[model samples]
Each structure stands twice: as C-alpha cells, then as structure tokens.
Target: MKVVEQIKAPILDEMETFEQKFSNSMSSKVALLNRITHYIVNRKGKQMRPMFVFLVAKMLSDNEKANERTFRGASVIELIHTATLVHDDVVDDSNMRRGFFSVNALWKNKIAVLVGDYLLSKGLLLSIDNEDFDLLKIISVAVREMSEGELLQIEKARKLDISEAVYYDIIRQKTATLIAACCSLGAASVQPNSVHVEKMRKFGELIGMAFQIKDDLFDYGETAIGKPTGIDIKEQKMTLPLIYALNTATDKDKDWMINSVKNHNKNKLRVKQVIQKVKDLGGLEYAEKKMLTFKMEAIDILQQYPNSDYKSALELMVNYVIDRKK
Candidate 1:
C-alpha cells in the first residue's frame, strides 16, 4: 500500500469512535443526523488532521494509554475538519468535492449550513466528555482561527488587490491553524514541556502551509487535482501563487490577468490565457520552491523526536505534500 494509505489505517479506527460518540449523543429520531454522517463517510477526506494527532501522540509516547488519548484527540480533529468542509461548500457554492456532489449540492444551502452547525456542536459535546480542558482549548482556538481565516478570505475576495502576505495569512489561518492544533493537542497527551509542544506546533504549521500552497498550485496544473482550476480566478479570489506572481509580473501580463479574472463572461479562453501567463511568469514554480522549503522545515522538527516508525511516517508525510496530485 502507499504511504498515505498506510498512515490511514489507525486513523480509520478513530473515525469509527467519532461516529459512535456522535450517534450516542444525538437526541432526535430523525434520519437527518444519519444522513449527514453518511454523507461525511462517503466523502472520505484524506483525514490528515487526525493523522497528525495520532502521529504526534505515538512519537511522544508509545503506550496504550497514550494511544487511547490520541484516538479521542484525532476524532475531535476530524469532526472539526468535516464541519469546515460542510460550511465551505455552501460558502463557495461548489457543486462537487472529492469528485462527488457536495452536501450543499444535494440538500441545498439551508440544510448544509445547519448540518455544519450540528457537526460543530456535536464535536464540542464529545470534546467536553473527554474532560481534557487543554484539548478543548486547543480545538476552540482552532475554530476561532478557521473563522478568522474565512472572514479574511471574504474581505480579500471583495477587493481585487490582494497582497501576497495577506493571501498567505488567510491560508495559514484557514488551513494551517487546525493542523497546528492537532499537533499541539497530540504533544500534550505525552509531553508536558512547552518547548516540545511549540516544536510540534511549528512542524504542523509548516507542513500545513506547504499543503495548501501545493493545493493552490495544483489548481493551475492539468491534473485531477486541478479540477477547480479557474474557480478561484472566476470567483475573483486571489490565491498565494497568483498574488505572488502579480506582484512580480510585467505590467502588461498583470493587466491581462486582471481583466480576465475580473470578467464574468463565460469565455474559457480568457481563463486559459491568464493561466498561461501565470505559468510563464513562473508562479507555479515559485510556489513549488516555497513548498519544498516548508516541507524541509517540517521534517527538521521531526528530527528532535526519537527515531521510530511514527516519526519516520511524519517525515514521509512531509514529502507527500508535494507528491499528492489530488
């Protein structure tokens, strides 16, 4: 099996636990909760956040007690991640995700929005049961970061003039914050040292940053990961690669891209032209180099931990950021 698949085996067990926790707490006899759960399972995201929690726990303490604590932590992270996706689809008006209809696409915006809230509430309730106040704080802060990230993106979306720094800040909060939370919570399960916790958090933040950059770069590539290539451009949202390139591009190139991106006309050629210009100006390559640097930084942090399969796996996951085509 591939490395990603290998890392997934333990996380799958935690996902089951997350489901049971939610199912037992649910009050209504309505099938709505079941339907929502089923939709989430069918979507089957890569479960990266959970893996971070598990891996960090394993590296910190290779014991059964640590394992169980890590399992619960991973479950919380996954729940939080799923809730974000539900809300994201509604916000983006996206019809498809992971090559299937989004929950919003099938159930409409109102249901999707409510279901997202339900998931978040359920996650909070489950978190409280664990009585890990520190864990709860970590998750709560992550949710706050996620919201701020979304709001920042929205504000930037309204204005066509997005700076490279602003775009990266948005992504860091939106995507990296939760991953960093996972690492911090996981480290807390084993080590109480603030230094180790900070290191783990740094590791997660760097890896998460690389992951999102790769995702944005994938948009411009002709790969399965590039499915929503022109979506950001069409929606007039500036991602990191575009923002960086625009800052560096020749005035003519920038003008062409600005006009094409701002245009609401359904001319495929216009989007293509901007994409070509982006590629020609080395936007994708610059992003790739940055991703490599982040990945390396993440791996460097792992070296402080004792060598183990768990540590090795975390190192491998760093490379997987660039390797993952989707």
Candidate 2:
C-alpha cells in the first residue's frame, strides 16, 4: 500500500470525526472571519499533526477507541498549527501556501494577523472549555519552542554562522517540538501514563528531526518540491546541508560560500554554485545519514509498543517522513 493509505486506513473514521471537530472549532460569527477560516480549512494539507495524535492514542489506549477527548486534543493541536502557519506566511511575506493563496495573500497582512490571533485563541479556549489542561501544557510548550526556533533561525541567518549542533537545535525546536507534543497529547488523551507519553514523545521527536532534515535535503535537489530548490540559500537560511558543507570547506571555499549566501544569493549562478558545493563536499550524504539514523531510532521506539495496526501505521509514517518528496 502507499504510505499515506497505510497510515490513514486504520484511523479513517477518527479522521472524519476529527475533520468535523476541526471545522467546528474554527467557527466564527463574523462573516469575513468565517470566510477566511473556511478558506484556511478547505486548503489544509495532510493533517499530519492530528494524525500523530490519533495514531499514538490508539496505540496506547486499552480499547483502541478514540474518545471525545481524543478528538478535542487533535483539534487543539491542528488549530495551533494552523495559526502558526498563518503567522509564518505573514512573517515570510509569502503569498502562497499549500498550493493556494495564503491568508495574508488573499486578505492582506492585517486580516491575516487577526486570523492567526483568532485561531490561537480558539485553540486555547478549546482546551479550557474541555478542561484539558494536560493537553494545553503540551501544546503551549510546542508553541513557545516553535517561536524560539524561528527567532533563532532569523538571528543565525544574519551571520550565516550556524554550527551543526545549532542546526539540530533549531530544527528540534522549530519542527520536532510540535510533533513531539502531538504524540504526547495522544498518549495523554488515552491514559496519561508517563512512560507511554514520554516514549511516544521521543519517537515523534526523532521522526520530526528526520522530517526537517528531509526538507533541508529538498533545498539541494534538482526537482521542485512546492518551493524552489536553493530557496533556503536565497533566504540565507543555514540549513543542515549548507552547515555541513561550510564546516568541511577550505578557507577560500568557505569565504566564497559565505559571500554567496550573504550577498549574491539572489543570483541563480551563485545559488547553483552553493548547491554544487554542498553536493561536492558530501553535505547531502551526511544529512541523509543523519535523517536515516533518526528514522531508525523512531522505529526502535515503536518496537517497544505492543503490536497493533496503529503501531504498524506509525512505523509506515516514519518511513514516509523521509521518503516523501515534499
């Protein structure tokens, strides 16, 4: 079966219910707000964060039934994630998202910011209304970490001095934290067993790390995956591949790279040169090795859980994280 089918087959019903809950959670009385929310909901991507919540919940729950609390937990995570994406589009000045015009693009920056704020508040209120404090705590930490990661990346981009260690730290906070929260929230919604929650959290973190690395690798590839190749370089974002290549390059080569990223990144020739340098220095291979290592670690964590269809689906998701082209 295709990876997506394998992951979704076991949780089809839960996903349908989660979708309803998600839409309901975002409902607004104001017409413009409602329209924007509807547009955002309609253009939603794979819903992978909520998928993690359901998959981990089922794997950890005794009866494997996703209760109302599970659906609420998933809805809360999705709201927070959606809010972040809206704000991210604004901050990046991006006009498109997920193959559609971004909220900021269609509604302008002011409305987009308000929409993001509305989504964030709705998520917080969902947790409070449901009295799901544990889930709120998990989601709150993920939000904080994601914010810190974005700021850190922006700070590092100005200097283009990101170390391999700093690169990992950035991705962990920016990307992995949310995924980790999804797994922990899933386990919490089911049983609140610390052991189970921590295990799934770690498993999700590993895969999340792998997922970001795979995204970084895409920046160096010849094919376009949503965004153009070397967009990271153009933005002066020091991703894993560039970090690796910069660390191994000679003084003269490093100077050229630094200059290219800092000044000439907009030039297609310079960007291509940067891409070629990363390839020539084995940056891509190094990143792939690290990504696979995390993928294996996530799989090992799954092995500790009892065998179930949910477990099998989670395993497939780990494979998909690295294998997905976009």
Candidate 3:
C-alpha cells in the first residue's frame, strides 16, 4: 500500500465516519448550493487536514475513539479550508483544482465567490452551534494568517527581494498555520487545557514548514512533481531554494538571476538556466537540509507520547510531509 494508506491505518474508522459528518455539515437548503458542495466533496484532495485532527485526537485519547468535538473540529477545518481554496481559485483565476474543474470554472466567478462565503459561514456556524469556540479560534487564526501571507508574498513579489526570514514568515503564515490548527484542534478536542495541545500545534507547524519547503523543491525538480520547473521564478514567487541561491551569489550573478527572474521569466531558456544556476549554487541542498531539520524536530515531539498506532501514524505523517514526491 502507499504511504498515505499506511498512515491512515490507525484512523481508518474515524476517517470513514468523519466523511459522513463532513458531508452532513455541508448540507444546504438551496439545491444549487448543495450541488456545488457535492462537486467540491467528490473532488476533494487527500484528506490530510482531517487526518491530522483524527490522528492527534486518537493518539491523545485514552480509548482511541474520537469524541463529538473531534468530528466537529475536522468538519470545521474542512469547511474553512474548502472555502479558502474556492476563494483562492477565484483570486488566481484558476479553472482547475486536483485535476477537476474548479467551482468558478463550472459555475462562474460570482457564484464561486458566494459559494466560498457560504462555506465560510457554514464553518463558523458549525463551531458556534456546537460551542467549540476553542476550535473556532484556531481555524480563524489560520484564515487570517493565510490571507496575510498571500498579501505579504504579493507585496514582496513585485520587487523580487525576499530574505530567508521573509520567506519563512510567508510559508509559516500561508501553509503552516492551518496544519498547526489541525494538530492543536485534535489535541484540544481530546486533551483540552493541557500542554499537549500546544505541543501538537508546534509539531504540526514544523511538519507544515517542511511540507512547504518540499513543495518549493518540486519547482527545481529531480522528478515529475506535477508543476513545471521554475514556475515559481516565472511567477516571481520567492521560494527558499531561489532565495538561497540569490543570497549566496556574487553581485554580478545576483543581478543576472534577478534579471532572469524579473525580465526574462517568460523565456524558457533563461528559466532553465536559472533552475540550473540555483542547483549549482547549492540552493537545493540548503533547502533539503532545512526541510529535514523541521521534519526531525517534529518527530522529536512525538517522543514524549507513549507508543500507539496513532502516534506511529503521526510520525509517518511527519516523514511523509518531507518525503512526498509531489
């Protein structure tokens, strides 16, 4: 079986149940809304966010069975995350997601934006109705950070000058915050008010950091990682590897790279040369090392908990974040 399947071994039942809960939570009175939601649900990507919620809850739960709040937490995260993705598609003018036509592609942008707002409201209501304020707070913060991260990236993208510190800040807010919420929500659902909640939050944040770095590495590919090489440079998204290369380059080389990324980004040959230059300047190696560091730090947090399938699955998750090919 694939590593993702293996990671789900311990939480298979919870995941199965969470599916029904998640679908139910999205139910709407309007037929059009329901139809759009059905499409979203059917085309969902790997349910990694909910997996984090269930795995952490079960790992921390005494009976290994998740409670109502855990299910609610998973549903809320999914709803909010889906809303963000829908809005993102509209913002990016993207027509495809996970190989399926996005909501805006099929239904149009105006409807898609409304659908996103509907999902956001649904997520907020699910938490408020259940009085899961703690869980709601976590998701709220993630949404805020994700928006801030996107804006921060855009603000920096124009000038094409992003320090390593700014790069970390962007990924942490854009990607890491959501994963952190998943782990923390899991812990809060089971072991509320304990240090475990904060611990799991940190664990997820580290894994998220590693995950984004791995994603950045894909743009400077050694494999078929779905996206085309140097896409980040083409878009002027200052990812880690390129940033590292820029940081280490001589003045002349730095100008050349900046010119390549800024002015000649549309030129395939220049982009290819930029990719090769990043690799030659040790950018890829530096990024891989940092990714592994975050992965190891995440694994260290799991050491405090006793042995369990849930814990083992979480460990597998941390490794998978860094090791995933795409």
Please name the candidate that would achieve the greatest TM-score relative to the true structure.
3
- Greater lDDT among 1 and 2 belongs to 2
Candidate 3 per-residue C-alpha lDDT over 1-326 given as tens digits, one digit per residue, 9 for 90 to 100:
99999999998999999999899999999999999999998987889999999999988888757899999999999999999999999999999999999999999999999999999999999999989898899899989999999999999999988999999999999999999999999999988889998999999999999999998999987446444478888888898999999999999999999999999999999999999999899999999999999999999999999999889989889888877788
Query: Order the candidates by lDDT, highest first — what do you get?
Result: 3, 2, 1
Predicted candidate 1 versus true structure: per-residue lDDT over 1-326, tens digit per residue: 98787765545555566556534443346698677677676567666776788778877875743455566666666676778888999987999989999999888999999888877777787768877667777888888998999898888777678887887798889888888998998897677556777788888889889988887876687366455366667767787778877888889878877777777425777877777778877888888888899898888888877888778778778888768867
Task: List TM-score per model, in order.
Answer: 0.88, 0.96, 0.98
The per-model lDDT (C-alpha) reads 0.77, 0.90, 0.92
Decreasing TM-score order of the candidates: 3, 2, 1
Model 1: ten consecutive residues of lowest lDDT = 19-28
How many residue pairs clash in model 2?
0
Candidate 3: where is the Cα deviation over 4 Å? 224-228
Q: Model 3 reaches what TM-score against the true structure?
A: 0.98
The C-alpha local distance difference test score for the whole of candidate 3 amounts to 0.92
